[model samples]
Target: MDFFLMVISGAFSFYWVFLFTTHTYLLLILSQLTYTDQIIPFELSTHPKHCLSVGTRSRQVRVPRVLAIEGPGEANARAERTWRGRVPSERQVNARSLPQRDSLHRYEFTHPQMGTVFRLVMYAESETQAQAAATQAFAAVDSLNASMSDYLPDSELSRLCNQSGNGQSVEVSEDLWQILKLSDRFSRQSGGAFDATVGPLTRLWRRARNLKEMPDSARIEEARQMVGFQNISFKKGQKIELKKTGMRLDLGGIAQGYAADRCLKILRQNGIRRALADAGGDIALGDAPPGETGWTIEIPASQSKEVTSSHLLTSLRLANCGITTSGATFRYLEAGGKRYSHIVDPRTGWGMTHRVLVTVQAPDATTADAWATAISVLGESGWKKLKRKHRRLKAWLTETPITAH
Candidate 1:
């Protein structure tokens, strides 16, 4: 949502390179060019954090805390000179050479219900341009949140929820309508594995979680009766309606990804070539600069100190792609001495029990988000199904369970 660009000096022996300064304590080195006798040779970094940002509308709505830059030694020196306006001492040069900053132009905001932060980074042509872009990005995010959030009484989602049991057709904003249609398409493709018509089920579970007690089997079955994609109908140029009373719709599963996709479009339309947008766990990457393979992404590993071996993602890059992760790491309830995650299978009316996490890569955020949820529910079988149906979709699953001695 926010943009930034660094014009570092071409790498040369003893050459001075300048990196831009930001408010966040991170630097993003877009590229490093080695200038030997004025001949420029470039190398790409295999790090996702190094690549441009990507994601949907919600990402642009939030601000980030860190931004890092990468460059050769000469470029770093030049960056220091540009920001500090002086030749750097050895210590300053060494410290600045690595991606460290005291501040950045990016901004961050927290979501009340989602319990996570959203970030937007920008590289504008000038200070004025940067501010304008940031302002627009923030406004866009507010508009999106107002439209999609269920917590807001007037939000499109909230209005729909209120009319759930009335069998009344609701007119949704164009943006929200598109997301629902996409969810329908994905649900069919995944054999009802990705349904947005699980509002009743999700709400029932939320209440059960708050009470710290499992819902009665009959109650769950009653809620399940209202949870089916087939229950909601939509037509082009028309309002969407629930076929049966008590049927509801919730877009939590795919809304964040849709927001990411929308934000990416806005950034690209504004002539941003490289950026990253993250809405919760959904991330989208803009184009890698010329000669760059892709953005390098870090898949957090079992230990906080270590991530999956970098070698595992040696060639992984998200050039114009979307990445989303779904896991039961949080938001669960305990019953009968067993833990149940917040994510539920629409068809089964049960919370996901296996597979601790699932990360998916796809052409778009919506697909990535829905597939991540569906596959996590499907477990190994879903993985196989996805591999057979769509080769372009790549996935990873992690599981951890308690063992009794």
Candidate 2:
């Protein structure tokens, strides 16, 4: 089976932080990472639209129109042609040997964004070209963070959050519009298992985790009342209306995925096909590395073993898709004699007390990232419910969320 839930035997935290600059980036640090020993075919599309959005609603919005970098005109220019990278034929591939003439070199560069180190790994023939492309890609990621980050009070998302119950339709930029549209689709598919308008609830839970105390029931109920996808509505002309006055929107679940998608787009535009962009841990992969079957990923293996120098006991290989892991193994709160996962449930204002982890491989990071969170909240049933509609999607979990296929 392509999708299986492999229970992790240990606990690990994703604690990573470093100051960054658009100019200076991370050099390859081989000791910090490792690959999953096994390899599997990622047989998937490599087209470069860089868009993870699928199945357009006849009357709905499309991500194809703009990049939202420099108003509508710049977005139109970037959207000029759906860019894509082409994979080499089988004869041109040698899993055992590196490329011959062009001599593909593996390079790693990283910049800090969205609270984690965003790493970029790729094979390129020219270092100059690769550097320029990486620079542009990181820039794109920063631009997205500026637009979507709720932490930045002046960010577009923050400004939009202030309008939660203004009862006025606000026209958002292309980037914001596209992600919201995608969020709406996911919200509908998961039966409210995922909601972007859980800002108020998220705040309460964040404070709870910070204080190592349970939030008051009265406060949770009040916040829960403001959390619902139904409170927000999309309108024509790329506008959105927040039906409730005190509502807030949060894209924490999907921002990394969306950022990964955008970076891949920038990479592809620069003719860099064999690429991988990791936003925190949410990764978007391109064509397999030259002469390689797929990228190797180190998957967590045991719950009984204590996490030390290496927590990953097994590895898996994949290509041409996005993959991410979301779980209670790392972030959580312990107060009042019970552990609470950092992944808060929108339906309830409390952090999930269950110890579970979900990993999803999808067509793009945006899809993988969002679904991972939804599945964690929805548990095993979420997989069974949405698998039929998302046949191409594959998932693995640290808990028995899905029986082995």
Which numbered prediction scores highest in lDDT against the true structure? 2
Expressed as tens digits, the lDDT of each residue in 197-233 for candidate 1 is 8877888889989999998888888989988888777
TM-score of each: 0.69, 0.72
Superposed Cα deviation of residue 26, candidate 1 (Å): 44
Please provide, for model 2 over 160-259, each residue's C-alpha lDDT reduced to its tens digit, 9 standing for 90 to 100: 8788777788899999999999998898888887889988988888888788788888998999999888877889999988888788889999999999
Worst 10 residues of 1 by lDDT: 32-41
Query: What are the per-model numbers of colliding residue pairs?
Result: 56, 13
Using TM-score, give the best candidate's number: 2
Off by over 4 Å in 1: 1-115, 165-167, 289-292, 300-315, 400-405
